[model samples]
Target: MIYIPKMIFHGNPLSFGQYFYDVWGGVSYWFTSALSVAQILLAALFLSQRDRMTFYVGTCTLLSLLGIYLRNTLPSPFPWYYQTGMVSTLLMSLGGVYLRYESRINKLVSKPYVFGIAAFVYLSYVMITNPAHPQGTTPDICMYLWKYLTILCSIICIIALSHLLPQAKWLEYIGKNSLIFYFFSGTMLALFGSITSLLAPDTSYILTLTVTSIALLAATGIN
Candidate 1:
């Protein structure tokens, strides 16, 4: 997966799909993606059972697959709508797992405050060092840390929110069709980008970002 980005940056001629199999220089990205999918499936199976350890392991596996798949699947030129569909599916699945086994998870973590503080601190670090921020110019020491922190925060947030909101019935319903949202995000992003680019080829980044945000909100509403 890392190799794909490297090759793309280095001007590799292969199309996005072909690059997944370009293993002459190293591990084929395609194989990595496949392995990630298999891991997700395994995690889903584990989480579906009543065992807490199995559930934890499986959830991690599924998320790892999602990260890998998202990075590898550029989904550009296609409407951002498609991307949304995919993400929606993933989120919905995770939500379902939470709905079914959150109580068991809370028992295992047993220290919400500790996890919450950790997540907050990590989120702060990420905000401070994000590449988009002025302070982020110091070689991105916190960039990698931020990625891990965000993942941790996401898990903690989900658990905490589940307790507070307990009515994830709606989220669970949405989760059931998360793939549709994922697909929508991609398609919408692509469509919006294409139209905007065509209309404003020299548009500023800020403008593009604003448009993207608006598009995302609209897509969310649609979902």
Candidate 2:
């Protein structure tokens, strides 16, 4: 934003009077601002209402739905599910759903095989019903269902594995640093694009990816 005064725009993030040829480059300022504020409030409510189960669940559900809205309405060329507002809401909703039925869900997810089977089923379904479309929404009900399943299944698989694994100190450490590593990874990715372009094309992509991954890992490792 500080660079906006000088008319500098990279990837043309939403800003006044600056637009890129790509459809994704343009965004309504009011829409973005309103959504951002609403999302922040939703998140705060979710966190502050932690002790009240009913309120927590409601907040979670709202957040998750907000995430869906965020993705579907995003400018084209943007990564689906790329916005933080939607993601926060989605995660909150997931957490709410999980906590609401943790006892019952635990009984089923205790078996690691359940996760394995679920993951297999999800992949198989996707493969069998391969639909050709750009990286955005479709009128097909199956498309939205696929998105829900993919995200839910992944979280379920992770939870199942975590439950099955023996407790380990290293895993605990990594989990603690996950947020720091996540934030760092985004910044490094932006920087890497410019830095990596200077290298020879043949090896640049591979080297860039390798270095980025290593840097991310190091950030997590040392955090």
Candidate 3:
């Protein structure tokens, strides 16, 4: 149903199966990462705390470094879904495990400021040192490292901000239907753009963008 818009406007001729495969295959990395994390959780049941910590830490460091290496070595337009996906997922999963474990042990982890401060420091360093990159590539080693590290830091900061912010019913509503939003996001974005162009062709670009963003959010919430 979502592809109907693409077919009508863009003349996309892909069949349903092709569209599904293309879309679903893009998320296969998450499936792989989930499987790996499941194995780690199962192993954690038998391992001692120290062993679990060491294992998670080791995997996190190795995966981050590997991702940096791959970013540098792999050619542009690399198969990110397969290659970098595993690296990113494993790194994030392990880092999450370590964070959970630490939070359990340390009461200070309950404070959002802890992670918020760390995230700020990491982002500041990345901005100060690795400031420039070409349009489509990360040929610089510093930029490569900055890109991966900042992703982790940004995740931490977002989690911290979520903790710091007061809860809203609208956000909760969106969270409850996050999966629907995720699946429909691309289609809705395209559809919204078409609708904007048709309805308000003379609108300024900034106004069009604002309307499109609001429409996308509203569609996701309604879905």
- For TM-score, the strongest prediction is 3
TM-score of each: 0.41, 0.54, 0.58
- Which order, best to worst by TM-score? 3, 2, 1
Clashes of 2: 2
Candidate 3 lDDT tens digits, 13-123: 767676666445443234443444445543653365455556665665665566557645773422323435435545555555756766662445446677877678686
Residues 1-223 of candidate 1: C-alpha lDDT, one tens digit per residue: 3454445445667675654335432234333334344445555565667566445545554555554466456634122223323333344455567678878867754576866686687678767766897862533324533554566666776666666766666578657766556545555666677678878888797977977786666666886
Relative to the true structure, how large is the alpha-carbon lDDT of every model?
A: 0.56, 0.58, 0.60
Which is better, 1 or 3, measured by TM-score? Answer: 3
Tens digits of per-residue lDDT for model 2, 146-206 = 6667767777778877887899997787688665665455455555545565664456567
Worst 10 residues of 2 by lDDT: 21-30
User: Which candidate tops lDDT?
Assistant: 3
Backbone clash total for model 3 is 0
The 10-residue segment of model 3 with minimum total lDDT is 75-84
